[model samples]
Target: MIDWKRNFLMVALSQFLSIMGFAFAMPFAPYYIQQLGITEPTELKKWVALFTAAAALTLAVASPIWGALGDRYGRRIMLLRANFGGMLVLSLMGLVPDVKTLVILRLVQGALTGTTTAAQTFVSVQSPHNRSGVVLGTLSAAVFSGSMSGAFVGGLVAEWLGYRAAFMCSGVLLLAAGLLVLLGTREEFVRPVEENGSSMEDRARMFWDKIGPATPILALISIMGFVLLFDSAWMPLLVQEINGGIKGAAFWTGSLQAAGGIAGFLAGPIIGRIADRISPPRIGKISAFGAGLMMTVVGLSQGFWQLFAGRFGAVFCAGGLDPVFQIWLTKTTPAQSRGFVFGWAVTARALGWMAAPMASGTVAWMFGLRAVFFISSALFFLLIPIITLIARYLQPAPQPSAPIHAGRR
Candidate 1:
């Protein structure tokens, strides 16, 4: 048997570093976008849209291929790919002459790299089936922690140092993290089933075949995409107080982002492990509904704290969704197609992200930011029904292949 604790720690460490690098680059992108001096609302929208879309498009398109590659060649190879490729693209941004080059390279980076999937696959393979939720939550915790650090530090650093310096720093951090993954983690081999286990082999073969079908897994992915869009809308929906400069816009903005990341880090594990026991669909429905209720209440808020309270709730609800869905996905998938399915899932998530800024931003412009929150809050209610349907109708996934289960999961 594997030393589960040692392996999980290694993977978690790699994920923490990789996620930190990604987080470092994001908060400061707006500063660069503003520097480009194309601030017309529509044009600004287009630029922001294009930048996010590039990543979304790439992540969406590349996830399955990365996942597939991970399955056949080795999941470790995928991690190395994400690590090295990420270093290359981020470095380009630091070196690029203009915003155009940066966005183009970012999109390419998104297409080529997916650290999250690689990390998740690594843990999933080594972990006991029952403990998947707990392990995934631990990974989620690492991810959120990295982002929390990045956002808090990124905002402060960008404000202090120049934008170029921040970009260069991000590239360096990502490169270092990737090297750690290459040097430290061991790859677990996945081979064809033994002849004695013909029936099991045939069933496992079928799991691989199921990977391509756009089934409930994809549905979950698509819904998650919209969920993020809804989450993104929250900022645009901050209401008249922000436009009036209630109490330092920069602080508020950074605080909101940091707070959400923190909540995600703290709550992700609890939610994920709960899903392992109570069934994913139940958890999904509850979280979606809770998120909607909280966000809608936010739209009704007049005070900044009220708005932040809503933000916290929404983040908490959404935080657990990733691990829950990941558990669902890996469990249902055949080992051969785990990469493809997970990849496409990431791609779908990316598309949702691309749609978010535009959809919320445009709607906020027309109807007001509050309306954006109202609409998003309202829209999320649909997920409640969607997940309930899956829980009620679909067959439960069979038990996982090994004693990977650990923790309460």
Candidate 2:
């Protein structure tokens, strides 16, 4: 018998390192770009938008292919591919001579790396159906904790060494993560048998049929993903504005992001436990509203401490959104099709990720950086009613009892 708990622990640890590695240098991108000689505000914002959107676009295209491969091969191998690919790409990011090359590398990163999706698919496949909420939530907590540690330490690293050095450190962390997963985790994936001589169209049709039931849930996940990451690319710039200059801005940006990460870390498992018992839709509604309220506070705050407080509260509530939906998706999907479905799930979220930057970047360019927060807040609020509607739609129709039969006599 598989030791699922051991498997979960190992997967979680690897996820932590992977996310930490990415966060280490990524959150400092705007400043790094400044160092590359693009100092004008509008031009800077455009490049920042491109940097985030480019990866998301490619990830959207690539995730489903990778997911299908995961099912055909094994999820564990996919995990290894993502980790090692990220290790290669992120390390090279530090060596790029200009911002254009950096953007190109990000595109490649999106194509080659998707550690979160790989990790989630691996854990979901191994975990008990009944305990999906808790398992996934704990996994999310590992991600948040990783982000907290990475951002905190990375900020200091960026401050003392330079942004390039931070990226190098990130590469090393990814190397460690890749090794951990390779040595520690094991999967008993059995490949599904293909029908003899099935055409590409038949396979595509079958794929959609399997994933159809979860479409609404997938849509919600995408929206939430977009809302969650909408303001991230420009956050360092916001920190600079609050600090009144670029000097020491990276450390403070990292500190603020760390605050959010810590909040997410604390909130994930607790909310997940609650979701497993209580109605996940109810939890989702409450979390969305709370996140929106807190985001308003973040948008309106004029000082660093105020922003920090708001960031903590915002992420605390926002952290519950994805795992709750994931739990629902996990329950709805068949075990055999999970890798396939989750690949689409990742694609959906990547679509959101792709859109967020372009939309938020536009708002930032037109209205100002703070305006992006307000827009993000509104998007969160919009989810409340959407969740309510989706919950109602997903409810099974009441079945009518057959008429009482006289044949019993």
Best by TM-score: 2
Clashing pairs in 2: none
Q: Please state the error at residue 226 of candidate 2 in Å.
A: 1.7
Using alpha carbons, what is the TM-score of model 1? 0.86
Candidate 1 has its poorest 10 consecutive residues by lDDT at 231-240
Backbone clash total for model 2 is 0
Off by over 4 Å in 2: 196-201, 401-409
What are the lDDT scores of the predictions, listed in order?
0.73, 0.91
In angstroms, give how far residue 226 of model 1 lies from its true place. Answer: 1.9
- lDDT by residue (249-287, candidate 1, tens digit) is 334555666777788888788988787888787787788
lDDT measured at residue 89 in model 1 versus the true structure, 0 to 100 = 80
Looking at candidate 2, what is the lDDT of residue 106? Answer: 98
